[model samples]
Target: MSKSRIFLFLMLCFIGGVALRSLVFIGSFYLWFLFGVLTIAVFSFSRNRTALLYAALIAVTIAGALWYGRFVPEHLALERFVGQEAAREGSIVKDPEFKNTTQRLVVSFPEAPSERVLVVARRYPEFGYGDIVRVSGTLEKPEPFDGFNYSAYLAKDSVYFTVSFANVALVKEGSGFARGLFALKRKFEENINAALSSPQSAFANGVLLGDTSGISKELNDAFIATGMSHITALSGYNITVMLIFTHLLLAQLLLPRTVVFWASVGIVAAFVVMTGASPSVVRAALMGLALLLARHLGREGSVLHILVFAACAMIVVNPRILAFDVGFQLSFLAVLGLAYIAPWLEAKLKRIPEAFKLKESFVATVSAQAAVLPLLLYQFHQVSLIAPLTNVLVLPLMPFVMLFGFAVGALGFVSYHAALAVAYPLWLALSYQLGVIHYFSQFSYAQIAF
Candidate 1:
């Protein structure tokens, strides 16, 4: 096999090993033993090239299993502290997520810096990222409820403990690059709010910065029913659009391709940081970066290869994410659909009007929704029957919505009046999107439940 083929095979084997562990528990000793056996088999088969390749691939697979096995113990380490009421000092690692009257904070203690605890507190006592807080509450592991593996979901982030209605006190205000980034993010959010009204401003923030904290439950439910919630949560689709927009806009300035690529990468990196670099965004960014690298190198990189490389790179860092993070799963599947299914769909979708890129958007929406259908049903217990229609209506406007929203938010920092001028187009875009969501969501058959 060619070098690229060999590399792809090994990567796939490694991912299989990691997924195998996720589905079936294999002890460390067994994994290590398998690794040793594979090593011996490789040596024994050294005289036979084919046998050696097979042995090597098996070894790589075992390595993946071992990689995943290493983290299993750390996942269980926090269980000991469950059921105890304790006050622990920790820094808020992520921006607090506010929903209605409650704010959820992911705090990491110095004692166990790698592990995190989700603290649920009142929305009034706002805590920013990196704030050192003392939390007092009964520590509990998240239970799998409503057919959701909530524990596994949290486990993907090393968040193994939960503290409900916690007595949280800020011991010290945060300071550092992360804190500064968050402060900037908060300022942007304030600017957005000042420029636009509730729900619309909230939607703007969601698309522009992946800040869904301001989105209302009713609007949120509408998005969910319409299968448009991914717009609010940054995903591969948004990143792809942003990257393309950046490249084209920068290209118009007559910059060299190298300069444009690097500048786009920098902007995306900044966007990722501003969005707190959640795993899903990071995954999407990695893939986007990979594509940029391929284009820069003048190589026609395979999309499947790029996708696999990005995923394996992430799984190597945090194996649990492969199985536990729903966002990662959705992002991967969506892109996988774009890479493989979308082209087939495009060919079959001939005769769909190409005006306004409707044909392109329709193919993408159908492919992605189809790819993620099984996972959605398994995870959420419902399917958006109107997903393709709603996505087709909204996807085309997303780039404009994001651009205008971002422009208004950034302009708000300089002048409220200046921001309002930009906000008009953004308002119109959001109104249309919200209208589509509301109009489609009202249908009884918009979504179907098991």
Candidate 2:
């Protein structure tokens, strides 16, 4: 590896070390710094000592900053109300997410030693983004459940305590960019419903924009049975597929590669933002945009750099995601599979014709599945024995579904009838994909439970 790549590698090591330490304990960040210092000391005799030392020091600083930003708030917040419940007022920091019969919102307290609380509200009477409300509820701290640290999951976003079924009054309505984005997202969901009927509409909402709110339990189970749950869970693969498709189509328009690359980046970023910039979406956007910039600069060898750097950056920004976020884990691993394993498998699939996206889809599916399989088994004990086949059959149709879904929403913004026209083919592809999932799910061995 080049010096830059070496630097990237060691930097990632530091960040990964910090992230792993955070997963197991708190207030041990200095250990990571010491480890980095030791690593640099070991490299002191190398010809590239100075350059590598700077790299190590930079990584140490990032690791320290990320750990501090991640835990200091939680420490202070826990000190404030470690044992008792008290009335507190905070601004609703995030849009209310209504999932599986519960409404979740992050509220930021205004008082000293401010902390963010993940408020689990009653199913009804939804709250909006930026809503300032006085809340009185038992502050329950999150803890690990079933090998997944629910606490770390919330802490990834700087949330320490949770308010359950709290007595919340909307002292003020939400405002600003996030609020508008939330409203727009709700409108898009409404448009999805208007464009397609139930089940299909809900599934499309999930696939195209990561909204599985309206999907029924049975249907969700079917998706998992077919090993297609990644689509519903906002896998970065979905976003990557859309970006590739958009780029491919626009490349034929005779647009300059520069324009096409940046346009694709913009489109991917816009979609990520519209989908609330979930960890997976942001990761995918970063990776996709990095690839675009790579192609633009004629430096394709930097893909590993891009992937590692992106993962480290995300960890620095939110280290909790390193272990706690399943999507984050699967997304990075899947991309790694694509980057390394897929190329090696080309000879194995050389006989399969690459037409109609058959070859590409199969290779990508197998690569990602192989990379993510162990983690899947560890994190979610169930596995779809036929996931490779299911993905091959369904993933190729995703781009069409996504594009048509977007068109339906954009047109629905104007007229329902216009949106309906696009919905015909959109629904057709979605139904076909759903039919594939449904059929595969019928087999007794399609998926196995632990």
Q: Clashing residue pairs in candidate 1, if any?
A: none
Off by over 4 Å in 2: 26-74, 78-86, 112-114, 277-280, 342-366
Clashing residue pairs in candidate 2 (N, C-alpha, C atoms within 3 angstroms): none
TM-score of model number 2: 0.86
- Backbone collisions counted per model: 0, 0
lDDT of 1 by residue, 1-450 (tens): 899889999999999999999979888888888878777877786899999888878888888998998777544566788899989999999877877788999999877888889999999889898899999999998898877788878878778889999999999998888778777778878888898887798888888767787887788899889877777666666675556556656787999998999998988887776556666778877766765676567664466677788889999999998998776787778666656786688888786766655465556656666676677667767789988788778876765676577677677778999999998888888888899999998888888777
User: How far in Å is the alpha carbon of 66 misplaced in model 2?
Assistant: 8.1
Which prediction has the highest TM-score against the true structure? 1
- Model 1 is weakest, by summed lDDT over 10 consecutive residues, at 356-365
Instruction: For each candidate in the order shown, give its overall lDDT on alpha carbons.
Output: 0.79, 0.74
Tell me the lDDT of candidate 2: 0.74
lDDT of 2 at 234: 70
